[model samples]
Target: MTTSSPPHDLLPLAGDFDPRTRQDWTALVADVLNKRRAEGDRLAPDAAAEALVTALDGGLGTEGLYLREDRPLGVPGAMPFTRGRVVRDGTVPWDVRQLHDDPDAARTRAAVLDDLEHGVTSVWVHVGEDGLAATDLATVLADVHLDLAPVVVSSTTDQPGAARALLDVVGDRPTAGGNLGLDPVGAALRTGTTPDLGPLAELVREAGAHDGWRAVTVDARVLHDAGASEVDALAVAVATGIAYLRHLEAAGIDPVDAFGHVEFRVSATADQFLTAAVLRALRRVWARVGEALGVAETDRGARTHAVTSLRMATREDPFVNVLRGTLATFGASIGDADAITVLPHDTVAGLPERFSRRLARNTQILLAAESNVGRVTDPGGGSWYLESLTDEVAEHVWTRFQEVERAGGVLAALEAGLLREWVDTAVAERDRLVATRQRPITGVSTFPNLADTAAERRPRVALTTTDAAFAPRRDAAAFEALRDRARTLERAAVTVRTIGAQRDFGARQGFVANLLAAGGIATTDDTTATAVLASSRAQYGEHGRAAVEELRAAGAERVLVAGRAAELGDAADLVDGEVFDGMDVAAFLGDLLDRLGAPAEGDPR
Candidate 1:
């Protein structure tokens, strides 16, 4: 059959304009920078033009421009799989794995079957501890078609039991897909135990008898929840995987078979571009490791399952988490993950209801069916930014992996507190970024809806444990703490004393109000309130100072100016403190909450 020519075929796309060179772009950047430059202050042309570049962690960055690729990143389903490890054959590019954690076997079974009937391709069940009982595994899977739909099981401290229960459900099935979810290093990291590789022998051997089930999983979500950077997570995964491989080798498994026995679970967040890049980077780096081990080309690439980050979910205004999940799923699919699980939006709130699970399942479904995001192979493959970013991540992963190895592998790194130090540093930086609202979390720290009622869910069973080597850290935790305490305050309303008209005070007023509401405190214009804030558009030293003094005299115990403390200048002493952008919000809110009055018992947060 012959095809008709498209409209663009008849025209030269950029015909009216000359091709713009980097030099021309640089000149324009320099001109723009000149306006922001002070009088008589000059910058070198190159430096001025390069100021548009952005700095990211792991020495990775984005330039004002990326040169077109001089070298090709190879095709999909091949060695070094930078583009992708596999080219999907259908519209649904990845497995839709739904997580089930309800302790009720009947409840979990119903949700599992419902999800599968809708769109979920696999099930990852939490067993033991606070989740479904390991003994009840059969009850949960009795209705499930084990051969057709894979069932993976994870436990806090009972992998052997979980695996045994899962195996019983499978019976003599010749074809099954899913992992045993075994990670000794991950367990050690979480429980602060010494590394245990003894379980690999029995588990790996038993898993070999099953056609599609893998016994090992390198779950980097442990580090991700602990606030490890993307590079740190990847590096830890590599180190952990290496440690596993060595153990498997000693257990007498062939290198080729050993590689197939393992899979990876990566944490995907709202940063979609970085999420995709990190996955692609994992493939590139792992492929090289396999090559060095003399493993075959096809077995080299890691099997990846992307999970929407647990650490990114907010307890307050959790509806925003739906958007975060969508972005994560998009990134995971475009990066060619073998499977993906998006946590329910209300995950942090409590046990997710059916509504939340349905939304979670349909998230990937709509992305595939409606958006057709899965129609193409490696959707982000050819972009200059993506390719460059992937390379940058792979390089950093290798460097960090080498560092971990030099410190005596993943276990030793954990024992020596090396890994903890790495996570702590990254966490502090993340805390700073989140606290300053530099990386604004919508509906949490930014644009908070104080009047909105909190989403309700069934209370989940809580699990106690030994002191964890790496405790989970959430970006919104600090702000949420403030919000929690603000709710418990005896006097929850603070007077926002605006200076001049709404326009005069609108921006700062809005800013101050939003900031206060995030902590669950209400705002008012009542000058008789104990705490009064001068939100203004007028100059602080000129029009704002008198308003602060008036508020102070009107039974107001404390007065605040909502502008730069520096801008306050001579009027600084007229008010208690300044409320401005880049201020330490947690600190500011914390101090304010303390001044207002403590909760009935103590600080609830």
Candidate 2:
């Protein structure tokens, strides 16, 4: 029978209540009173009386990621289109843009072709020692049908020759399109070289001179990856974009034309919600920039392209990198990016192996074809949570952008080391959290075994740092020591086999619970006939023995332990029926409901 305590017994009333109440009404009253008192004392007393009046007066509200009554971005699709989407018939799903940095020309060409064949539509050719050189450029780009696939070329130097070279192969083709990027500021900041601002501004004009040509204004992702927060990255990007516009305006291009030709490449990290919000906020911030330049909002949304950031990619357990990439890809698509890039999982080390690149491409294919993620237009559009966060972040970015403007634009801010200082603060905070494991990386910080001996092919970049030697240090010694200690505690632990129609079912549940308990086997309630849900702590030595004895008494036999196929000894034996391993949740749930005589035949939701 269901047992619930009396409402009055849950808290104490001002007067007396019956002691025989089953719902703990008295305790409820006490809790309510305590919470009310705590909340009353917690808020600032000075702002209390007039808070509602001020809120009604539009003192506070949402702006992209910030709130207010006055809208700066304008309504969706309307000119100065900052408040919403601009495409007349909804945005085209963001393209699956992958990066290829293989030094081998033929191999890199084949890799790019493979991604295109597999449904990826855009590619970014990395700059520096790892990227294609003018010598290897032709061979690497020879068979590239730009009409079928767009290419984004990035270089460390301000020289647009390589991009120009790549573009020459497809020369002014109507269907051939992409961004020409040479971040002099980013390169100078990275290499401590004097930025050639004049030539760089010239390249913007020269590239935009071609129809369908997008000359990138900022690659602020470098700062974000190097340890800048969303606000810092957005602020720098906005300031940089403004500086570029002014520079172009002085170079004889109208500010409107400058904004149209320039696209801001942003970071789409692991924080899915944040990624979505930041992308939306990016459009708003840029819209505000346009408004400041006296341009309409609708024209602004047409100019942004969001690139998924690879900075959050971890070298450890490279597979987890796939999950992060998928999430980032989805976030970008939902956030309405014109294009998105999914970095290979092993990108942190060096150039990705063919296997990693294939996995990355297939991930997008599965999401678009199988998962149908592409079918939805702006999946996060009108989401309250996303809208609120977007407004908050936009406001934060707006404030910081203003600060940079006050510091005399991006170039001046960087010259004054203001940008660097802000980036340093973000990096320091990330480093601090990572050190304490408060922001732990799964296979990196929790468990690392140097001798695992699994051959891993990683991305190759010329850049190196002393921090790479031991940063994000995993506790190998502690892992082994804990494993050793577990051996002694085995007497209390019980191995459980949870049977389910789907193989991953029990394993996922068991893993979640075991992780929550820190260690020890925890089984799911889904078994053949009976169910078991016990905490890891509850299954200690003597307690485990008693629990097992009780299970034995309850008539359980031939228990199938739920775990990865790698961990399971006899996967075939466990698959006694039509049990699918790692089956889709929708299909699995459909089957489960059908068996319960409440079939889910419509809408699937």
Candidate 3:
């Protein structure tokens, strides 16, 4: 005979542990804070609570804890719809949109069919520069059922022609959904060309007679790819949308009708919380824009397509991207995104294989089916933390949007190079964090898997960044550069000259070894090495300095210190540089490579 416990009481679970209150938690945190703070500069109760605040761009930030007072409420399918656009009662959650960019027409056709046959709801094909050509659209979509599987096309150099080509294929197909992908502004930003909305306006007007097709997709992903903050993306997307609205209006299309024609494609990063908040904010602010333009409240909700971040993909340990994609998809699902696309894990290295593409689409399927992540409506609505963050993001976005309008909107800002400045600033801060390892890019900057082998793929057409066009970038490029150089150069003889026993020097020795491994270099204990790094702040400080100097005098070409160089006092001049947390690892490794003849005598920088 078994006894059932109380259904919702704490007594059963708290059999041994004592119950704790907010005060108890605060007190414990206070103890830790006081220990870390300087003596006599201790934080008071109020300041202690705020000490864990995390700063974000545009003065938006998050605190360690949010309280009841911070809560702001909203319902699903309501005006200023921060919760969601629709209230679902066990309905299909979101569209699983997968991207295909293979240049081969036959391969793309096979992949597109495979994706649609196995849980994928929509196809996002990239046409032009390095992607499928315009002539190949017919072949790629030959077997795809236009009524069942929606196809959206994006292009850089082959814009209006590509849009027309897709339309020709769709012809008079009933229930054909998806976009013509005539994002003139986005194409201009990507290809450094002047935007002409005449074709887009014409498409929107002509497609109005049809049932399920949109004209333009105002892709805000360009902003994120170019290293803009969420605030920048929100502001710029609004500005671009309005710009399109006015252009379409000038060409005799109503604002309300134009609203239905444009869709937004935004970036969803691995930071799930921030990603959710930003997406919510995008919906909220876009609703306000529609209201300002005299559109009905119900039609104001922005249709958003969330694509998992391309910038977060790593080249070396590509497997880590599985987790990244999963987190991004979770964020998009909870954030009430209409559709999502997950770029394959090995995307940064080259073209993704069939296995990579399968994993990408299945990521969304597992979350939707097994996890039931989308069963709940507005999962973040009740949480004080998410609500506060959403409000903050929305407010900041409005401020920036107003600023952009004052500067004559998105086109003018691009012309004035103001958008470039914003992207540059955000990129600088992001780069600084990665350089210092404060951001800690797993498998690249921190805890890297040195023995992992790179998966080889066919050579892909390289994408580039310029002052005129927003471009894609990877954070691991710096460390990867070091690794590339190390691969080409002769392996260095790196020895750790330990000053103390295991208890003292072991930690620093391990740290030094890890740092070397990041550059694809190894370490040894051989005293007669090309380079030696003195490890530990052993009790025999002077003796340690003398030993390093002796090694350098005997035959060592380069000598570095595991600890701070200043710690050696008079012998500081003998050491080359210091290796420690927050040090410029790139510059250190680059200089070392130069010393080791990395360029191999003839290659130009």
Candidate 4:
């Protein structure tokens, strides 16, 4: 049987343009830049034209072949569901899941009731440490109607006990869409100790006896928090899911039934497009896996749960994290996740206050009810850019999955430290980008608020035991540490000396000011400041030296110039150093703080 091709007009740019036209467009761009250069503009024609083309084309030359292709995304609820699994017909809202981690059982119970009573559709409880103990399951969920509002329990070391406690509460009544959240592989990966999968399998068998309950959870957010790339995280998630399916099959469970027993959890970050693409890619890859296993098309698509990225949350200017969570939640919705959890803005600080928890829940409520973002299925469907990106992400993730399979699967890869090595490399590159400001963390590395008070401290109840496996890390941790050092000083101030007119120095002035403020150093125009940052777009022929000397004469102990080093000329000798893009911002600020007599280590403010 042959399929008919889509109508010519229905295809993207079909017959409307030719690839050869790119040469003509490039020539036209070059001509414009050449004319500008002839008119005495200090621009390289070829370079300027190339940049213009890149800006207009929406793809960088460095992105290689991945950015150049436009792939078709099939209809939603179909095989290889790159678009989505279920068609959300504007009536059913995505599940708004709230996380409950308060260790006080009574408080946790009250909070859970409050959340469910207000807007939360489901509750995710952490059992142990900063979360409630498994023994408190009955107390915390006493008021909850298990059949109406689903409850998900997560435990690090006590999955079996937690599952049993939850099941005991669930007792006899058919569970209404709850997940046992028994993840033995996740526990093993985190603690670097193999957990006996027997209990988990038993729990799965027991849960299988009930309706609307899933036993296994494949959470890839651990890998993501440990600095794994998108592909790496998705690959690990797929491998874990496959491993669970195999294990269950080995235990006399049907393959399709075992597949249905699992759910996937991934991280959603502030990068909306990437988050959406990652989720889309995950579903497609999982669908392919199910197809290979001969599962029905309806059972192939993954049931995804998206949690806001922990690595993206900041302790500094944490209010910005609300915005991040909102964006991530939106991205997750567009990506067609079955459920989403928006972490409280202050989560990185300590146990979240009532207000923070309310805000976290309300964020999803507002998106679903107010903005009506859930009114459409696969909102990003049919967009050329999203489709192309989704396909690219799926390809890369499948390749990584293949590598893990070749290495004898996820557990073997983890035991051999190959997964950690991959994640560490990604972490190193991410750290390098963060340090150099290539990947600017909004509150910590970019527009830092120096005058903002520190986040309120809360005594955390220990929840999970730390192990030697891939540890959680935040991209802003190093930068926040530098700021901590600066905060210890009685007075941390840097003078920004502007040269030439406002237009000439405005950009560099702001640049140097933000850089200094990022390290908790206030920028001042006062002569009392010991350090001076000279900012200018003007050439440093003679005026630059005079500015540096003037700062030195005005009680400045160290002088720094924010401009090209080559332009410093004779002023290079007068200034302590140069500040520019791609510089080690943390190191530069640390040295500056030390030179300015930062308080000794362990000295209290």
Candidate 5:
């Protein structure tokens, strides 16, 4: 049998200027800049001009590079599914899965009921240490109809106990629509100890007996929170799923059936396009895996559960997290996830209060219901940029998957520490970028609220069986620590010595003030300040020098210049340091606080 080619009308056509390449665009930009210089228009600096060219050419870095050759993206719901698995019409919206890990069974139950009563369609319960115990399953899920509202349980080390408790509550309900989420491999990776897969296989077999229930869950969020890149997360997920398939097959289950009992959980960050592309690429990779196993395309599509990235949440200026969660939920919806969970805004700080949880739930509700984002299928499908990104991500992830296969699969990699090594490198790089403000975290690294009070909430209980090998990390942790240090000081304000009028120094003043505030330092214009930050534009060099002298003469203990240290000329002699973009803000703040004689880390003011 031969398959016919796709219709020509359905394919994308080349534009009239198709022959024009990125090089041609670069040349044009250079020519325009030169012409502007000749016309005495005072063009942007050389560094800034080149940066613009790079941004226009989509060549900022590996993450920024994308090719146009991967266009058209094929049809939605087709093979490889780079667009999506199914063309969603507006009738059915993506499931809003609210996560509940409150240790109090009563509170967990109330949160669940409140979510279901509002807009949530599914419940994800954390069962184990630091969360609801297995014994509280009955109380937590008391009125939750197992046959109607799907409930996914995340049972880390206590899988067997949690499974038994949930099974007892579920009884012999054939129509129960929920997932057991028994992931031994994930637990092992998380806790640095191997679990007995024999129970896992048995649980899979038992859970497979029910309808609309998945037995094993491949949680990429574990890798994600541990600082894995998107490609690494996808590769690890595929390898994990493959390992589970083998486990179930060894236990007498068919490969196709084993695949059916698996689900994927991934992290969705504020990078909406990257998040959507990663999800789309995951489906493609899974499809290939299914094909390799001789399964049909229809049986290969993955059921994805997307959660807002924990790495992106910040304790300082927690309100910005609401916006971040909104964008992440939008990305997940665009990526065509089966269900999405928006973690509470204050999740990183501590156990989220009712108000924070409500905000998280409503973020999804507003996007799905009011924004009408669900009405369109593959909303980002047709764009040249998104399609190109999707294809590149798929290729990169597939290559990583092959590497994992060669390294004796995910389990071996995790045990050998190769996976953790890769993730640590990525995490370090991400932290560096966050530190330098190359990737500015709105509230943590930029526009921080120095006056913001600590969020009043219950402290999160520690998990007893945490793996020191692959412990979860937050990108904002270092900055938050600096901020915490700042909060302890009795007097930690910096004075901004504006050189010249507001127009000359306003921009630099704001920049310096925001940077200081991010480290928990307030800003003042008084002479009583321990340090004075001199702000000025390039044209006001003399003014800046005089201001620095004035501040020093006025008995300011230390003076810092804002802008390039070299641009300050003789003014640099009067300043203690320079505050500018790409500087190590955290370290600078730490040194500043110490020099100013602020209280130490544990000191109570």
Candidate 6:
């Protein structure tokens, strides 16, 4: 059939579409039609394609590429746990669990009471070699209202003594809800001895065979707190749980009945998204496990216990850890964890001071009461970014879980060093970031007032073993010499100082300059030679930048920046350029000098 020209073809178009001058190339009919024409021939080069080719050839150096591909994210609450389990009916925030790890029963009891008074709804009594004993269980549970509160206990073994003691304390109290952790996988990981899974399975069967008690599959907080990523932590946890379930099933317990008694104790880190995503992904994977065992999907969810991670806490900035714990608490709660325990901010320093404990309890209280963080379920739902991140994390974890399974499940993975290697890689990356200050820690890395710490306070008990346990015990003089060396180095370090009303800005810049100087630059060693600039304005800008440039010109490889908020913007730029994002500043400077044909360092020409 013959076709007539369109009315638009009869009129002249106005805008230019030429490569040289086109305002909108999309309107060019030839270019648009040429796409189809070129389909049978060859494709034309574009900036993106050229860039990709150049990158591939190592010409125009770039980091990576984006390829659009879709992978299956199992339905929410489905197998392999790609998305999440438990589509929220509404926001039913996770239970609040505070830890009572005191070796002394009376002290632990006091801590438990204190936790209860501060809006804590659950208590986790740790009974490791360093934790409380079964003998202390009674006093720990005494006077605490049991109707609504739940307690969880962890030990190195599923020894009958620990379980019998715990069960005896909670006997006949309608509200006496708690789990005696029988995590053989975790026990094995910590103690270097594989547990007799037969006893563990029997314990599970016994717990499930009864009522108001549980034998949990404890993953423990050690993995995450020891530097494992969310993906590794959750994957290992799921694998461990599955390993337990298999053992139980083989022991003639129903598969569905097997998982019903297990509980997970995971670490809650400062990475909020990661923590939340780990829980969500865990639920999904667990649901699949339940399905594999012929359990109804609706009844597949397991109780999750979260504890504040010790790995990220710093002995230097003890109080600032309060903020990290708060974030972790909120993340764990929102992640639908059944319970959460926020470690005292100063717990890393040994014992938590009363003030530190108060701060720790207050953090959770503020999140739950004042912030009302517990009122919403899946609070992160429907967010494109969070959802996408949740998917990515779930997929990553699922892949890792499969790898673990292929290696004969979680315990086998650990035994074969797969899990340790995974954790070590992540730990190395995190340590590198911390060392470089790419991830700035507020009080510890940035500020220095090491001697300004308050009076010492001991914790009810130490959860972590000291270096003395691993290393040979040193005599008093040897220890003193080590301390003296540290003190000497601290005194020899460069310090930056910026003057003027712009105190905060200058302080931050000085912080960055000092960090650089510590990294090998020969800046002024005097505390006064630290980068310091005086400015009238309350903001940071070119004046600050110019000051930094002048400092650099004056052989001040590291200069402290000081300024007000007005000067902060400029100081931030300088730090960002010289320290944080500027990984190749030295090379760039050398290139500039070479381009100018300036004499190289130590050149005699």
Best by lDDT: 1
Q: Which stretches of candidate 3 lie over 4 Å from their true place?
A: 1-28, 36-38, 70-72, 89-91, 463-467, 549-555, 564-571, 598-605
User: What TM-score would every model get versus the actual structure?
Assistant: 0.95, 0.65, 0.92, 0.89, 0.89, 0.68
User: All candidates' lDDT scores?
Assistant: 0.83, 0.58, 0.80, 0.81, 0.79, 0.60
lDDT of 3 by residue, 193-228 (tens): 687776777878766767888888888887788788
lDDT of 2 by residue, 504-539 (tens): 355454443333222212233433232233222111
Instruction: Report the lDDT tens digits of candidate 4 across residue range 54-105.
Output: 1100111122122334555578888888778888767666888998878888
Q: TM-score of predicted model 3?
A: 0.92
RMSD of each: 3.1, 16.6, 3.8, 5.8, 6.0, 12.7
Tens-place lDDT digits, model 5, residues 226-313: 8888888888889989988888788888998888888899999998888898899899889888888888777777788999999888
Per-residue lDDT value at 298 in model 4 = 83
Q: Give lDDT tens digits, candidate 6, residues 498-550.
A: 43344545545454454433222223444343233333334446655666666
> Taking the tens digit of each residue's C-alpha lDDT, what string does model 1 give over 369-448?
78888888898877998888898899999999999999998878887888888888888887887888777888988889
Report clashes for each candidate as comma-separated counts. 1, 55, 0, 5, 0, 28
Once fitted onto the true fold, the runs of candidate 2 whose alpha carbons sit more than 4 angstroms away are 1-75, 79-85, 88-92, 172-174, 447-455, 458-461, 464-605
The order of the candidates by lDDT, greatest first, is 1, 4, 3, 5, 6, 2
- Residue 469 displacement in candidate 6 (angstroms): 12
Q: Which ten contiguous residues of candidate 4 have the minimum total lDDT?
A: 55-64
User: What local lDDT score does residue 430 receive in model 6, on the 0 to 100 scale?
Assistant: 56
Better of 1 and 3 by TM-score: 1
Report lDDT (Cα) of residue 102, candidate 5. Answer: 88
Lowest-sum lDDT 10-residue window in model 5: 54-63
Model 4 TM-score on a 0 to 1 scale: 0.89
